[model samples]
Target: MRDAQITDLPDIREIYNYYVANSTVTFDVDAMTLAAWRSKFYYLGKLGMPFIVAVSPAGQILGYALVSPWKEKRAYRFTVENSIYLGAASTGKGLGRVLLGELITRSKAAGLKEIIAVIADQGADASIKLHRDFGFEEIGRMGKVGYKFDRWLGTVLMQKSLK
Candidate 1:
């Protein structure tokens, strides 16, 4: 695992777009463009947020974990939302835990105070448990807020304090 370089953006985009096209892991119904990912990479770099990726011994990106500003307002500067996505081949290999652990450590080192996870309620038990194991607590749930895969989907909100 390491800090993501500009070259990693394509792999990151592929990893995330897999979920976008195949699952409700993300609400994005369309694949994100490389330019969009580049903009996000630059934005996080400017904020000094954690955006790290796990790679195979062959140097292929396996997964990634990052924290982005939770809100645009100045008062929300200390809080951020966390995102983790692994290539389909990388799941069930404990990479999520390692990436999330590293993400938390890096985020705290970057002086962020909190991390929030907004997870899809459908088919995401492992994710909920992963966050729980890391000391994130379920704070709330919003039901029927997202329509995807021909159904109404909800979100499970979890939060952890770095302090």
Candidate 2:
């Protein structure tokens, strides 16, 4: 895994858009534009958030993991929300686990006190197990909080204390 570069945006968008269109991992309905994606990169860079990408030796982007502020309030400054996405071919290769582990380590080093993962309840057992393996515990569940693909979706909130 390595720090992501601006050049990696296209591949990142591909993976993200795939999940957006076919899975409930992300709540976004529209595929984000390159400019919008660049804006996100800029914003996260400005916020000093960690954005790491897993890559093959041939320079293919396999997956990415990142963390951002959980809330905008000052009191929540030490808390962060994490996201991880794997390229279609890279799933179940232990890459997500490696990326998430690195993310948590870096987050702790950055003085973050907590990391939260908001996961879709459907077909999310792998993510839930991954987070649980990293010591995250289920903290809350919000039923029918999201609507997508003509159905209501539930979200499970899992958190790990970094401090």
Candidate 3:
């Protein structure tokens, strides 16, 4: 994995939009346009967060991982949340774990003290397992906090310390 470029936005957006529309992996109901996607990445860059992607030998983007502010408050500066998305056909591969592990390394290098993964719903077992395998512990769970696809969904928070 490597730093994401502006040109990689299209593939990233596509991978994310797929998860948005097809699953509770993300609570966002609307798929964002390329411009909106670019704006999000710009914000991450402005925050000095790492946004990395894994690519195929032919240069196709297989997956991406990023770090974002866990909260906007000053007290939360040392804590950052993470996001990872893969192409629909790419699930079940070990790529997500590798991508997230790289993000953790970057987070530590950035002097971030805590990393969190908020898995959207129980259906996202793979994500939960990924974070757990990396030594994250389940910190909390919110039930029916999100309404998507005509049903209530929950979120599980997993945390790991960079220090």
Candidate 4:
């Protein structure tokens, strides 16, 4: 895995948009255009967040992991929220673990004190297990807080202390 580049935005968006269209993994209801994806990518970059991607032997991007401010307030500067996405074919192959582990390492090295994972309760079995394996614990859960696909969804917030 390596730091994501401007060129990686399209691949990352493809992975993200799949979830948007096919599952409750994301609540975004609509697919993001390339321009909007670039803006989001630049926003993370401007915030000094880590955005990295995992690639296959042939240099195909398989997945991505990134972190952003947990909250906009100054008090939340040391804590960040994370997101991870993998290609449809990359699931259950340990790529998520590798990508997330690297992201955690990068966050710690950047002097961040905490990493929080806000995961969708539905279709999040792998992410829940992955974060658990890396020592993250569920700190809170909000039920029926999001509405999408004509149904309500919940979120599970897991956190890992980097210090």
Among all candidates shown, the one with the greatest lDDT: 1
Q: Which residue runs does candidate 2 get wrong by more than 4 Å?
A: none
Residue 148 of model 1 has an lDDT of: 86
Question: What's each prediction's TM-score?
Answer: 0.99, 0.97, 0.97, 0.96
Q: What is candidate 1's lDDT per residue for 12-59, written digit by digit as tens?
A: 999999999999989999999999999999999999999999989999
Model 3 alpha-carbon drift over 4 Å, by segment: none
Cα RMSD, model 3: 0.9
Q: lDDT of each prediction vs. the true structure?
A: 0.96, 0.93, 0.91, 0.92
On TM-score, who's better, 1 or 2?
1
Using TM-score as the yardstick, the better of models 1 and 4 is 1
Q: Please write out the lDDT profile of model 2 over residues 69-112, one tens digit for every residue.
A: 99999999899999999999999999999999999988887888
The candidate, 1 or 3, that scores higher on TM-score is 1
lDDT score for residue 17 of model 3 = 92
lDDT of 4 by residue, 1-163 (tens): 8999999988988999999999998889999899998998899888778999998899899999999899999999999999999999999888888998899999998889999998999988888999999999999999999999899999999999999
Cα lDDT for residue 150, model 2?
Answer: 98
Error of 1 at 7 (Å): 0.4
